[model samples]
Target chain A: MSDRDLIIDRYKDLLKTYLKGKSETALYKGQQFSRKLIEQQISPDDVLSDHVSVLHELFPDMSEELKDSFDFLLEVMIGYGFAYREHQSLRTRQRQLESEIEVAASMQQTLLMSDVPTVDGLDIGVKSVPAKKMNGDYFNFVKDHKSVSIAVADIIGKGIPAALCMSMIKYAMDSLPEQRMQPNLLLENLNRVVEQNVHPNMFITMLYGLYDTDLHEFYYAGAGHEPGFFYRASEDRFEDMFAKGLVLGVSRQTRYKEYQLRVNLGDMIILLSDGVTECRTSKGFIERDEIVDLIRAHMHKPAQEVVESVFNELERLQEFELRDDFTLIILKRKV
Target chain B: MNIQSCVEVCNEWDIVSARQLGRNMAKELGFGNVDQARITTAISELARNIYLYAGNGKICIEAAEKMGKRGLKIIATDNGPGIKDIRKVMEDGYTTSGGLGAGLPGVKRLMDEFMIDSVVGSGTEIIATKWLR
Candidate 1:
């Protein structure tokens, strides 16, 4: 090869390094070398052409094989760069979606969360877990002088629509006057609101209970929801607390029946979404007896610990991946 | 055509699944929306009966054809305490539990054929079949 060819080869090596490293020093040196090549009357395009020839010279026996090797490699690198750009954009989009869900979840959590009314003579504990980013389980506490009203509802569906319905329930509940002390009245009113506003396809199973400390009575109603458990300390037995009512949003005029329970000292009232009792075991689903047994074991603890222990035990039974929204509320009557 | 589906009716959520299974089978059997709705409602009542009385049970949904006409069949079985009086249960407003008492009679009215076999201590099995016109 001629002296000019050798110089062009050196430029090719330097330019490759400059492109690879994106090094400013390599770029500056390359600029200086290009200027020197210009000064010496050598063309830069000739150097690029010589780069291919250099490979050909190295593979003299395979000259024809190496002929378009550099161009092919450059083409492959350009395709790789396009794919890399696409990958980066996808990653960015994924991150944005994840963060958006996080924001929505937090916002929904705030909407679902309410101050557990610290009523006199009652220790209340509540917990909720969504199987997905959004939960359909709901619980609320509204208190007056004589009674603290509690509502635990599970939407018949999941995701955003259920979340929206839950908000509707909260507002409907707040719109009621204080005269709606009766659980049956509260549920009836709430059902009317749901039936009028929400889509017919969507429904809710709810249990509304108003515990009157003054009367030592707990008035409760159920709208096709799972029965809550009442632990009678005096009898050393469990009584299922349930009332007859259809699911909300089914009919506008549907009336819920109310039942009364005497909330005795040391007795416990537990309300849970079906997710708690329907926790999928290897067999299919956990039995209510198992749930009662677990609660009985933790009956000695505070309301908060009862919820925690029951949740932990149920989660263990299901291997920690809850497939539905879990909502539990425990109200303990202290002596 | 005999397409069948079996689901465990343990809780209220399972009752919903059982209802859906009945409707879906009806849909597959080419039943119209009204029939499908009736089948779903019947399944809901029956499934709730299993859940409320038995605590845990199973429901089988099947699509059947007889004399060149298609139909749907539902069989709900539970090991729960058997009903002492099947005839009384079929009477409207006869609820042993806290239910609305419209379940058994409502189910019987919804289907063309209904049969129940129950023993006091053993279990209860109710089968209902509806034929498409």
Candidate 2:
């Protein structure tokens, strides 16, 4: 025999030794089985006949029933191999999807204002949670010694585009000098910029406000934003500051409306995107009043706590994840 | 049935509701998932612009069959004030309010078709479409 044939014979002798007196025919059949046969490397018809004849030599009394058993084992092994290949493919696909989601989440995070600007006598806190890997809502605080600007805008849609738009809005706000303090003038300029550059159909609902810590006053402009809530600790009640304005990016000529409020000690200002009010409950949708009550319940808490409490309540009421991005900014004045 | 729907209002809370309703309508009409997301986002951006810059305006979401496929058309109209310069507004990184200035341009990218009509004093109307083929 050639050296290669000698190696095959030695491999068969080892198999026979391992199966001594324990079904020699089964061992011989298993040892001679070739996975390559099923893969069409060898003829399927000749594979079984040749392997069986080799096994019959090892066990002269071995029955045909034993040969059938060997065939079944080979079939099972092929099925297992196919299943393993499919499982490996699924695992690879899952890993790829996870990586994509991670990257998207990172991109979305970049759209948020990284740090809150510092202003005297003011405590501000902001929080945002996306329903998916990306968010459509954004908030930012821009400040100088004279005044602090707080902005909250919700892009009309979700995902990477919204995230990119959020970044654009942030960069625009960062480039604006303090001289552009007037909310209306600022929004007007922003409108022209967005209308000219943004997709013809995209727009933004924003509430931009400049708070003068020295004067204890807030100058605000609203463009398609929701009615903000102000809590008067002295009165122990909340009032809606429903300023009106147009959405951003519709027309270059559109004018924004401006409003003002005097900040007092122990007063709290709450700004939120539609996701807060539009959160759906098991029975139905969450009413605006319920959100107000939630704010009231956590009125005495810190600004951060107030924001977290509201989100917690929303989560408790809903069985499923929030359908939209949820964001909130709380501004509180200390005595 | 052939129908056209349009709304002109400030980009405010109510208008957002309008956009959401419009999105639902588009979905009911069997718009593709990707197309529906694009139209909804585009409409929201336009409505928001009307509220933010124009102070008040309106938006219209219309549906029609085009090329044997369902198509959604969105038009946002505002008379608040017209853009000073359309070219400047269309340019990226040029914002008056320190915002991203990405709203309009971003919407344009999301849609399959886009068009804009505006006058400095009159107002602006944007038309965009997503076809479910």
Q: Evaluated with lDDT, which candidate comes out highest? A: 1
TM-score for each candidate, following the candidate numbering? 0.56, 0.54
List, residue by residue over B14-131, the lDDT tens digit for candidate 1: 9888877887788887875445656776788788888888899899998776788778889999999999988877654556653442467667766799999999988999999999
Question: Compared with the true structure, what per-residue lDDT tens digits does model 1 show for residues A8-49?
Answer: 678668867876799999988977887787566443324444
**Model 1 misplaced regions, further than 4 Å:** A1-87, B1-133
Q: What is the DockQ of candidate 1?
A: 0.01
- Candidate RMSDs in Å, in order, are 27.1, 24.0
